[model samples]
Target: MRRHVAEFPDARVVLNMRSGSWALKLPFLQEVVGHSLRSIYLVRDPRAWIYLMLYNSKPSLYSLKNIPQHLSLIFKDDAVREGCPSVAPEFKTIQSVLSRSEANPALVLAHLWLAHTAAVLRVNEGLPEESYLQVRFEDVVNFPQETAETIHTFLGVPLSPAALNQLLFTTSTNLYNLMYEGDISPTNINMWRQNMPRKDIRLIEDVCGGVMKRLGYTRLAS
Candidate 1:
C-alpha cells in the first residue's frame, strides 16, 4: 500500500476491505498501515451484515466447513505473522464463538461481527482524530450527499458539486444484484427485517446489543 501510494503524488487511495474479521486479526498488517494512514471504518447493523454474507450465497449456509477455512486463509500472507496461536486472548474468544457456529450459525455470525468491529475500534484508539473516520453503512446509503461530504472533508479534499452528484448517482445506480429488490434507497435500511428469522434476530441482538448501541442503532422490542 505504501509503495503504491509513493509512486503518485496526491493519490488518495481507498482500500476497500471485504473481511473486517480477517483484517482485525492481523495486527502486523495494522502496524504496517501505521499511524499516518488515513482510514475509514464503515460498519453495518450486524444482523443485516451477517444476513447479507450468509444468505446471499446459498452454498455458504449449508457448508459450515468453509467458515474456519475461509477465516484461516488470511493467516497465509507471509507478512501476517504466525496465525491464531500468536494472536491475543481475543483469538481464544474467536475460537470459542466459532466452535458452536455449526450448531448455531447466527450466534457465531453475531459474535464475529462484534469481535471484528471491536478489533478495529481497538486499533483506532490511539490514531489521530483526523486519521480515521468511522461511518455507518446505512448513513452512506440513506444520506448520500451528507455522507459523501463527510468523507470528502475527512480526506481533506474538496467536494465539488460535480463530484458530489457523480458519487450520489453511482451509489443509487449500482444496486446489489439479487440482494436488492428495487432501486437504491434508504428503504433498504430495513431490508434485513424481511430476510432474517426472528430467532436469528434475537441472537444477533443478544450478541451485538452493546456494540449496536454504541454505533447508535436502536434495538427493536422483543
Candidate 2:
C-alpha cells in the first residue's frame, strides 16, 4: 500500500477478487482501504459456475492461505500464470464431497458453489448496501449499456455516451479478435440448460435453492 501510494499518488487502486469474497475473509481490508472504497461484486449463474468447475476445478477452488500467491499469478501477464480462485478449497468438508472417487462432479461443484456463496451472503449482511454493488453476469452481458451506466454511477464516475459506446463495442466483439474483442453474448446466459444433465441441474437447484432465491434466480420446476 505504501509503495502504491508512492508510485501512483493521485490514482485510486481498484482491487478485484473474483474467486473468494475477500471482504468476508479479511474485514480489515475495508478499514485499510478506507471507507471511501467501493466494491463491485460479480455473481454468476450457479449452473454456469458448475460448468466451469466441471472442466476447471483446482484453479477455481479458493483457499484463504494461498490468496496472495493466487492473486500474484492471476495478475501475471503470462498466459500460463492465470487461474481461477477459490476459498478454503482444501477444507475437510469440500474434500469429502469433491474426492477423486466422486462420480458426480456436477453435484460436487454445486455443493461447493453453494457453500462459498452462502459464506459471502452471510458476511455481507453486516455491510451497508451502498458500500458495494452486486451485478449478475447475465445482466452485464445482455444489457451492456445499462450495466455499464449502473456500475459507473455506483462508483461515482462520469461516463459519457461515447465512452459507453466504446465500452460496449469492445466488450461485444468476438473472442477471436486478438487485439481485443468482447465475448459478450446472451447465448451463455442459459447454456447450462443444454449442457448439464437434468439430474445434475436438479442437484444444484436443490442444494443452492435459498441462495438462488435471494439472488432472484428462478429454479426448475420440481
Candidate 3:
C-alpha cells in the first residue's frame, strides 16, 4: 500500500475478489493498509448464480454423478476452518445437507449459497455501517447509472461525467457485441427462469427461500 501510494498518491486502490469468505481476510488487510477499508458487497440472486454455475460447469462438472465429489472437495478445504473461524459451524450444516441421500445438484448448490451468504452476513454485523455497502446484482444490471453513482458515493469517489457516459453506453450495448458477437441477451437477470428446470427451481427455493425473501428475490415456486 505504501509503495502504491508513493507511486500514485491520488489513486485509490481497488481489489476485485469473488471469494465468499472475503471477510476473513479483512482484518489482516486493514492491518496492512493501516486503516479501515471501505467494502462493496455485491450479492447475486442464488437462482441466477446457480444457473450460471451449472452452465459453466459443463458436461463433466455438471453431471449428477460428479456433483457429490465436486462439492465434497470444495467443502473439505482445510483453509475454510483456518481462515474463518466464524464460518466453521456452517461446515457441518452444509455437509449434512450434502450427505442427504436424495439431495440433487440444485439443492446442494442452494445450501452452499446459503452457507456462504450467511457467513458473509454474520461478518458484516461487526463492520461499521459507513464502511460497508451491500448492492444487489439485479439492481446493478437493472439500474447501472444509479448503481454506479451509489457506489461512487459510498466510496467517496468522484463519478466523472465522461465515465458515467461510458458506463451508460456500455450498458445499452447488446451483450453479443460486448463479447465478440456471441449470441446472448443484453440483460440476463431472469434467464434462470427460462433455462432451469421447474424441479430444480423448486428445490433451490425450498432450501434458499428464507434468505431469498430477505434479499428481495421472489420465489417462483411454492
The candidate maximizing lDDT is 3
For model 1, how does the per-residue alpha-carbon lDDT over 3-97 read when each residue is reduced to its tens digit?
Answer: 76456545554544664444453344445555445667788888777776567555655264466665555344425344434443444465665
* Cα lDDT tens digits for candidate 2, 1-222: 756655665667666767545746534555555566677778887977675545323354333234324334423443332463433332224444544463355665576567677776766666566677889877877788999989999988887989888767755664422212124456644666776677878888887888899987899775
| Candidate 2 Cα deviation (angstroms), residue 160 | 2.3
After superposition on all C-alphas, the RMSD of every candidate to the true structure, in Å, is 4.7, 8.5, 4.4
lDDT of 2 at 194: 78
Every model's TM-score: 0.73, 0.69, 0.75
Per-residue lDDT of model 3, residues 185-214, tens digit only: 335557778877888888888888887888
Per-prediction tally of clashes: 0, 6, 0
Candidate 2 stretches with Cα past 4 Å from truth are 1-11, 14-23, 55-92, 170-182
Show where candidate 1 strays beyond 4 Å.
Answer: 1-36, 61-65, 72-85, 171-183
